[model samples]
Target: MAGARFITLFVILSSACKVNSQSSLLEQFVSADTTNRAARFAYLKKVSPTDTICLNDIKRAIRDSSGDSALFVFNVDGFSTMLRYENELAQICKSNQLKFKLDIGTDIGYVDQTTGCYQDYLDLILFEKYGKNFKPDLHKEANDLYLANHLLDTISSWDCDIRPRCLSANTHTSISIVVDLPIKAHRKEWVVDKKPMFAVYHPFMDLSVVIDKDGNTSGYQLVDFIPARRQNKKYKEQLLAIAIQEIKNKYYKWKPAEINGVLLNTTHVMRLEFEAAAISK
Candidate 1:
């Protein structure tokens, strides 16, 4: 779990500018993390401060454990995974029934191939179309008040080359595919009722969720996190604890992923955005 231990943050413990480091505020926060050091077990990996893509943290992990129902990776390559193009890509994954991964690059293996839409993923990044439209990777210019927003839009008119079956051995069995619609069509999503002031700490946090066959959350894990360039390690445990709780409270589930018409357990990786403004008002 040493990998997980070093991970905490996209929760703050660094620069005063990355978060509201007021002693009164941070000291007031405490959790089981300090007493038990539980974060060591749940932590994923610390990300490079220069990287803006939130999904970069867990992309590789998702690819590895995807077979045998280890995970169901969510598509997180756009402005808001639940909002615009990311949403669209996720739906596409659902419809295609290909489980490998979306456009984001994988940490373990190469994705640029005709097997699934990885070729398209490479095309999207090489094009870098979203940067012109959304102006992502602006965290350097951000502070405690307003943070940079990374908007990724990879869905273009090329039509995904992904098919139900790919020539690659791993593609069809890949668990990195995004989960489809809810079991019940009427289930609604929850809006952020209160935006956190400390959201400026990092761009996002990677979340790992396991859904049972019944379309319910069966497991949750912290895969990776994004942090500031010079983050403060003062209230690190407290921040980690708070962020975990925030996700547990905010997450919702509708449907579990199915392949070959079998309802099986699935794991999904979600890049939880901490940049408050990235969410619509």
Candidate 2:
């Protein structure tokens, strides 16, 4: 009777070991997503052994399935806009009894511009499921489509007048100011050197001007000065002084900016480009 009891005990122990081994295999294959690295590791460690069985089975089914036959689940908040599409996908999976992978924290508000359909978005979700096994041609096609749509959107919304124009003869000569705001300057031309080597020079100055609520000009500061050509350092200083003085002599009658019916002070940076051609012959 003792020997018979010993053999039964051995059988029970072996069976228990086999079950434990299978549970470990399931745990190894199961994937989980959490808020952060530390949380994910902790969750993985705390997962119940029974849960591994279902997770492992899903992983196996996804691996063995072909094409769209594979199923997946996106673990997102039910209130999310993505729920509508995910629910439809889930139903399809149910019909096939195909186990699916989990997608965590997916944004579903994204819609296609051309087709206005979710089919393209669904394709992306499926591609993500395949991971490294996804076809390169399909991935490239998706990227190309995205770029083409982006280009179209950019072209449609582009406003030429709002774009920054570099200081050039065509743009600088035709300065556009607000109707009430007129800029006045004392002298547009400056003599760089008055000695044996006399040269007439024109330089570009970038100035920051501030207008108060009363339409009065308040602050004036030189942001930058670019000389038409390289000259002596002392000569450049004189040119800058002349430019600042000219800007100071100028006056602006601004229409004050208002917010909620109250006038507000505003600041603007203006680039003044002076050309030698503008000088009297």
Candidate 3:
């Protein structure tokens, strides 16, 4: 009788353990949305008010998540307004040497065929004026853009080598920020756009993007953002130095991994530094 009771207890305990494991995985994969209201609310309470755009509201309705990282996924609407604010953010991350990934949507939103810029305001005009009968062709164009940019993997594959020996890894290490910018698509304006022109172009910033020991996506965090200038170049050097110092200090057991049976102890640090002029557009 005692043996039977022991077996029954073991079965119950195992079942509970399995449930707990599954719950944890769900939490990891789940997007930041209302379905996880309790967790989302708790997270917002912890964010600093100083973070340029207050993410408190969006936290409740996020469709994507960056694990425990407090990510802010801005769309074209927010991108327009955040232009002034984003530079500051880039500076902070650069100063702190924080490893982050910047994900940008490749194609989406209202695009101008002539200027290669998306006239995002057109959407508002169409909705207010023509309602559903508004330009279906334009709507289709925007839908196509969204579908093109929705693929997350493509954005994560950029080789942003602004600094020397930076971003030399194959694993996933990224931070994504989507912005809506007008692409100059007018035939007259087309002459001005350089190579690989788009009706609407999204800027992506990848900071400290590197692979992990387990052959998975992992990167170090650079502070937040730094100023955009010659001085920022020095800041990149300093940030990289600090990151290397920290890795040596903590995560002691973390050893460099071999890629293709070849060990690459490359002292490469991922960095993001760009001109305010380039990003402002």
Candidate 4:
């Protein structure tokens, strides 16, 4: 009886020591990123397969340091918007480092992850589900879909790098932001609009655009309107209608978003700031 009791105590102590050692390694990893600026993620990658403890520690550290507090706690909250918190966290991570990985750690539990980015706006769509996953067609243009071999999955955290949404990742890094570089489609380029007053009146609007797979504006609704100056009632009615008609006329000029070359019939909200030169028909 005494021998059994001794062995039990020894096991407990061993587990405690193991946990502490892993925690110590995590502290070093986080510290090195800040103080030991030379500690590369490549080095950590080499040690991850054999050292799951260190990898798991680093993974959790990434969450604790970068994960959204609301998402971790309020996943089921009725009034909060925190779906796909892991993707948001992933976005933050890749914003800092171009090529990175998450979920290298073993754990009792981990945040469920998906390669799809479906915001609340998609709730009304007639979607088919494969258990927790929706049809890949719905998410063909998601932000997370741009990663290398990305998937519209329902599983653990990113096994690969997570970067900007809808933007191609090759050679696109932090340096691109500071140069005023133009991005490809899915992001809009503005025009000089409003022929009535080339300098005096300015207007801006946000349109909730539903672009079909054919890259045409299937439908749209004005979400926001800001007119530089208030016009009379008749003019007000005509003004917004003209703006609406102007956008609808460009049906063939738009680009649809996609993933892995698969077209996505998704909704996009666009903000437009118009200059005096472009609004006239």
Candidate 5:
């Protein structure tokens, strides 16, 4: 009798363990498909644009498919941006009780909206809040660098109005150009750790204008990268132009050979000599 009771208890515990293991397996990452229909539908209904039901239709596809379960729309807007605001979408994921890790590739959407806060914070911590007259030498270097790199061809500039507070379809419609962030440069490298240069911030190469069907720009995203080699080509040409202009303005009285070879006659050569002197110091 004792042995039989012990065997029964062992079976009961083993069955419970197996059930728990199965539950764990159920929660693993799933692809965008039917099994995760419920969660996907919830997110669409919550965030989809009101004017068009295309996003809703996409969600319905998952519902109709057999055993397809993915948490978020994998294609439209990359996953990283979604995850950054996951708190807003947490309800759908929690309701589904699905186990998943979001694999949204590098976020290049360039939709930063905290301009006021960012500017205020930077002013408070990084630099003294000075008006237009308070230009730093670093700003001059950055400006020169940009002009030297982007002077060739027609560099396009646009004043875009981005709506940060607006997320839903209704708000997307109401987007207005209140204020804009002043873009400082194209290719810039800020020192993160002093020893090895790490590129922390870089402006996007391609500009994607996200406007409504009405032609009013709601938001814009930057994509595609202009390669470094291409930028270098433009930079060399621009530098040459600036050098010629400066020489003509300041030292045109001297002959070409003297201007090219002598100090103070050519800004390009003078800058080179100055750099060499600094290095020798």
Candidate 6:
């Protein structure tokens, strides 16, 4: 009786594994034909009844090896259908207690030319905010950074009644310019100890500066100073001091940002690259 029971259990497990393998393969076929709703539904019906296959079950079967599921909906479908599908997936995630995120890929078409232009304008503005050292990866955190600085409200209130103008004559051409960051100097022009020198190492110095309504620097703080190369403890301090003095000697100006014709306290980031130059006798 014991031997017969073991054989029954083994047979049941083998059949279960075979079914799971076939289900997984079927899910791959469905995922590959994302744009073909009719095909996918037919395959689902072949596996099980349409009424029995819920969104959650589809999510489970088609989930990648990392245990994450992604659904790609084509824009060829009307906006209503796209939204409806998204809502269904969202409902499934909530009911199943699953973490979900939605990313719209480049394949999605813009509603109009104006919408595309508006997106480009926003990108340009963000580029001005980060200056010449803008990193594309930092765009993900831009919203949080803008919110922390209370800039969103200020930007929304900008006077679109006419072409915007700077608050002062010294205002920079870039709308979101930093007023205290050093300009890029030619290597030949960079001098130390009153002698022309070549830079052996250069690194970026990250700083934040506050600008008042008058386009003047109110305060400055260093967030980080990356050294070009490692140095002795004493030399490091000396190099840092030199970098500080160099930045302090530079001048910066930006169009004072205003909201509804009222000047607001504004803070901007400055990324200064400091080079360690050595003069050869």
Instruction: State each model's CA lDDT, in order.
Output: 0.31, 0.36, 0.30, 0.33, 0.26, 0.35
**TM-scores of the models, in the order given:** 0.27, 0.28, 0.19, 0.32, 0.15, 0.30
lDDT tens digits, residue span 221-271, model 6: 677766444432234444445544543555444455543344545665555
Say which candidate scores most in lDDT.
2
Runs off by more than 4 Å, candidate 1 = 1-201, 232-236, 275-281
RMSD of 4: 20.7
The TM-score of predicted model 4 comes to: 0.32
Q: Model 1 clash tally?
A: 13
- Report how far off residue 27 is in candidate 5 (Å): 22
Which digits, one per residue and each the tens of the lDDT, describe model 4 over residues 127-157? 2112222212222222243433333332211
Runs of candidate 5 with Cα error greater than 4 angstroms are 1-50, 53-65, 68-281
Across 118-207, the per-residue lDDT of candidate 2 in tens digits comes to: 112233344556652232333233333433333322211011112222222243343322211122222334455663434444456776
Enumerate residue pairs that collide in model 6: none
Regions of candidate 6 where Cα sits further than 4 Å from its true position? 1-200, 232-244, 258-262
lDDT of 3 by residue, 229-264 (tens): 333443455544444444444322323333223222
Q: Which stretch of 10 consecutive residues in model 2 shows the poorest summed lDDT?
A: 154-163
Superposed on all Cα atoms, the candidates' RMSDs to the truth, in angstroms, are 25.3, 25.9, 25.3, 20.7, 28.6, 21.7
User: Candidate 5, TM-score vs. the true structure?
Assistant: 0.15
Tell me the deviation in Å of residue 247 in model 1: 3.4
Worst 10-residue lDDT window for candidate 6 reads: 112-121
Backbone clash count for every predicted candidate, in the order shown: 13, 2, 45, 7, 6, 0
Candidate 5 residue lDDT tens string, 1-281: 11221232233323322311332111111111123233333343344244123333344434433243333222211221112123322433345442122322221322311111111122222122333222232223333343344333222221101111212222212111211222222334556567645432222233233323222232223233332334333333333344334333433232111111111111111220000112111
Residue 148 CA displacement from its true place in model 5, Å = 44
